[model samples]
Target: MSAIVSHRLHLPGTSPVHRVPAEVKIVCAVVAVFAVVATPREMFWPFAVYAAGVIVAWRSARIGLRWIAPRLLIELPFVVLAILLPFAAGEPRTTVLGLSLSTTGLYAAWGIIAKGTIGVAISLTVAATTSIRELPGGLSRLHVPAMIVVIVVLMLRYVDVIADEAARMRLARISRGDDPRTIRQIGATARGVGNLFLRSYERGERVHLAMLSRGFTGVITEYGAEPATPRQWVLGIVPAVAAICVCACALVVR
Candidate 1:
């Protein structure tokens, strides 16, 4: 079976951000995220600056608001939780628009929304710029455990395989005059899901055997990845260092 080669989230581009080594991007993203996380929830101004930095990164990557906006839908559930936090959490109550609200909860909710929004934005920016194929090489360069990298590589490769298999099974069921819309037909839908799981498991077994026969090893090695130069590392790390500095300033102000 032909495996999917690219991530659905990856937007192909020739921007300099896209050209930076994947390891650098990973490190930068992680550092920035940590900085965002370290900033006190009460120190709201820093999060705004953090968001502006992310927006700059987006522009540098040639990504636009239109591209980033729809992807933000994935965070809607968390947004809902944030919205409910002021209501559900306990604290000294303050009246807002004649409605009783928790003072502490209001701050907590804002923190969640602000931090979550920036975190998701950063993640989408990275996903938009980085190809799925490059991630394993990046992780490998970070000295991450080989088995973890292999798992990540294989998971990315096989996700589409599982999805395609499920689609084909659904089509087969439809061809057999199975109407999945009826309440009485729920049993068939359940069975189809279970069958799909078993088929995927069997496929995995066969693929493992085939890999072993072909001299497959547990570790995934990428020989073709070019080494990251000192210049690249410097360029890549600047944004993360800047984020850390902003976080430090925010802490000092707090």
Candidate 2:
């Protein structure tokens, strides 16, 4: 499980960024994102500063652009929506390269793209530096609800299991000459999905039973996580502080 989590997102590194306590990194990432969201959409310079901060973080974490760039494709749906905004939005339009675009929509699109990109970038950077095992402890340290933390941890732990199960199911179907790509096989595909869900539910019940047999308690005990020191907090929070300052300046200038 540790190997899977490490390979999926956490880049193994000994840099200062990776060395910071997970709780500190979590707080910093959240604060920086909040600062970005608070900034006015009309202002563009602040986002550049935010991007620069993310770049510095990436550099510190020794995460290359090649590693992070592909992950940013997760925001493609938002980008598509943003692209349509200028065309579909209401009046107050301006001509751009022979196309009439909504002024408000343009700003909205820019806000979506800039904020989404920066948020995703920051998230990837944090993920690259912090392993999945560290997340529950970090959230717990941050005073998040215990149940919510448990749910997140369990979900992360079992996602790969569910994915592997789905893959195996697909292979079985293909081996039986079931071509899911055909429109005629849509019903079969739906049935396959339902079967997978049932299997997953049964598996979950068995796992829960096993846990109870092993004296499972409601509380999840975190191991190997040390408390963050003041120095670590200060160093980790510098980027977030910079973001907040930029947000404030953007608001003032606006």
Candidate 3:
């Protein structure tokens, strides 16, 4: 049987970024995000510089804006909040387009949009270059907490399984003459959802029992070869170090 794996966000590529160790890329992504976050909101020019660096990383990874742009929809709720900030946040109002808007609010909104976008861009770059399968291994290598790694790995793996099970149940309902579109059928739909959850829980219990019988251990070890070379480390960390330098410059200017 095929493995129950989710669709990977990672794009296939042969770029240097893709070749970098997943652990190194994960570290770099986190460092870059921290650099963006630590920058003062008023340091506008530094934020622009930071964005340029992220774009360069995207280029290196052979990732185009098309792939990254659509995924940004996940942040739509935050975007809406940011858009409303100038209208609703703090004092010291100024007129813009004949409407009174708070100057501090505008600055705060800019900080939210700018820093959030840069952080998301950095994260997308890392995801684009590294497959889902590698993420757990990377976290383990980085010495992340064991419980967190196991949770992440299991979630990634079984989410697809649960989804598939739900789909099959939905099909069965439809075949049995259940019209889920109408309000009259809403109760049935709710019951189906509950049933799906119960089935998923039972499946999980069976899987757990099977794993225990097979002598499964708590640690999810990676069966692989040697560690990342010095060259990979140098290439992987350059963008992160550059981002840190930009953050330092921003602080200095502030």
Candidate 4:
């Protein structure tokens, strides 16, 4: 199984953030994301403070930046697209390194950078500190669609399996001396993808039949009743409260 899948699952620990209720952490993450989204891009200071808030979570949860770094490659392209938006947006601002930029473009880029970074940070915090079982249930309670949760759950479960299958296929190709460097090999690569998809589809059907024979009423939901501790209450809401304070200060100062 992938480290991420295991990592998201609550690892027993004494960390403050980890000790917080899964639901509270999820809520905080959501609220923080919204705050990042709502704040104007030019308000760079808030983002700096917001990044501090993330740092606090990272420290509290005991999740290192190293764990979060690799996953960020998944985000780099979107970040690149966000950077490009400044050129495509409203009026041009001064050039950075000889590239003409615009206020609209600059703010656009800032918005993307801020929001995307915050969102990703929040999500990584949740994944790092919370367990898979508690995490999805938290989302379900927050009124996220049960179907979406189910899909996410199944997707997580199967991702590594699919990845391993793909790896095996790649290795087999490499062993066959199939150097896919030329455009001519692109068709073969597409066929490999198509083949992988078909195999996955067939396997899914088999899994579904096996599940049905056992019984699957669709959405899976199960959790214990040990309710979040008062300790969690303090730990969970602290960052959110600090965020509220930042917003309040921003309003008062402006």
Q: RMSD to the native, candidate 2? A: 1.5
Per-residue C-alpha lDDT of model 4 across residues 156-223, encoded as one tens digit per residue: 77777787788898888879988666787898889989999998999899988877788877777646
- Show where candidate 2 strays beyond 4 Å: none
Clashing pairs in 1: none
Tens-digit lDDT track of model 2 for 1-254: 66776777789899999998999998898999999999999999999999988888888889998889988999999999999999999999999999999999999999999999999999989889988778877888999999898788777778778888999999999999989999999999999899999999999899889888988786567776888999999988998898999999999999
Q: Please identify model 4 stretches exceeding 4 Å from their true place.
A: 1-4, 7-13, 143-145, 221-225, 229-235, 244-254
Q: Pairing residues by index, what is the TM-score of model 2? A: 0.94
Model 2 lowest lDDT segment of ten: 1-10
Q: Note each model's CA RMSD in angstroms.
A: 2.6, 1.5, 3.0, 2.8
* Best of the candidates, TM-score: 2
Better of 2 and 3 by TM-score: 2
Runs off by more than 4 Å, candidate 3: 1-6, 163-196
- Per-residue lDDT for 132 in model 2? 77
Q: Show the colliding residue pairs in model 4.
A: 9-131, 9-132, 10-131, 86-105, 92-102, 93-101, 93-102
Report how far residue 103 has shifted in candidate 4, in Å: 2.7
lDDT against the true structure, each candidate: 0.86, 0.90, 0.82, 0.75
Per-residue lDDT of 1-254 in model 3, one digit per residue for the tens?
Answer: 11334234668789988888889988888988898899989889988888888788788888888888987676777878988999997789999999999999888889889988888877777777876667777888888998898788777677777877888888888999986788998888899889988988898889889878988887666656346788888877888898889889989978
